[model samples]
Target: MTFVTKIRLQSGNRPALDRIVDEIRSTAERKGAELRGPHSAPPERLSVPQYKSTAGDEHRQFRSWDYTVYTREMEIVGHNELARQVTEFDFPDGVHVEAELKQVEQMA
Candidate 1:
């Protein structure tokens, strides 16, 4: 059986996100882990309505707070140690990470 670790990272801070990804890539390279891509996804633009007061007032609303979210995804193939390191990495503020582990069984 083999394990695959898929990591998804998202942040509004592009520089911070890229930095983390680069660090992971370097670590994987040093450890001789099979890494598949820091694949980039299209930036998602999002907006949130800002309210002046807690009270529900249609007129008392500020301009929409808009931001773009960037996402990067990578996979570590059969390198459980490297995957664990990545998942346990202490990312900076505003960066979100999601890791999924899947088991692959060979068919004889």
Candidate 2:
């Protein structure tokens, strides 16, 4: 049986996101882990409406705050140690991480 760890990272800060991804990539390279990629996804543009007061008034609303979120995804293949390390990484504030583990059984 083989396991695959899929890691997805998203943040509004591009530099910080890239830095973490680079760190993971370097560590995998040094440890000779089979890493799929740090593939980048298109920036997601989002907006939030600002309200001056809790009352629902159209005139009391402010301009929408717009932001872009960047995402990077990678997969660790058959290296449980490396995958665990990545999942347990101490990511800084504002960076969001999601990890999923899947078991793959070879057809014999």
lDDT of 2 by residue, 1-108 (tens): 999999999999999999999999999999999999889999999999988998867789999999999999999999899999988889989999999999999999
Give the deviation of candidate 1 from the true structure as CA RMSD: 1.0
Clashing residue pairs in candidate 1, if any? none
Cα shift from native, residue 62, model 2 (Å): 1.3
lDDT (0-100) at residue 31 of candidate 2? 92
TM-score of 1: 0.95
lDDT of 1 at 100: 94
> How far off is residue 70 in model 2, in Å?
0.3
Candidate 2 ranges with C-alpha deviation above 4 Å = none
Best by lDDT: 1
**Candidate lDDT (C-alpha), each:** 0.96, 0.94
**Candidate 1 C-alpha error for residue 66, in Å:** 0.4
Q: Candidate 1 on 1-108: residue-level lDDT in tens?
A: 999999999999999999999999999999999999999999999999998999958799999999999999999999898999899899999999999999999798
TM-score of every candidate? 0.95, 0.95
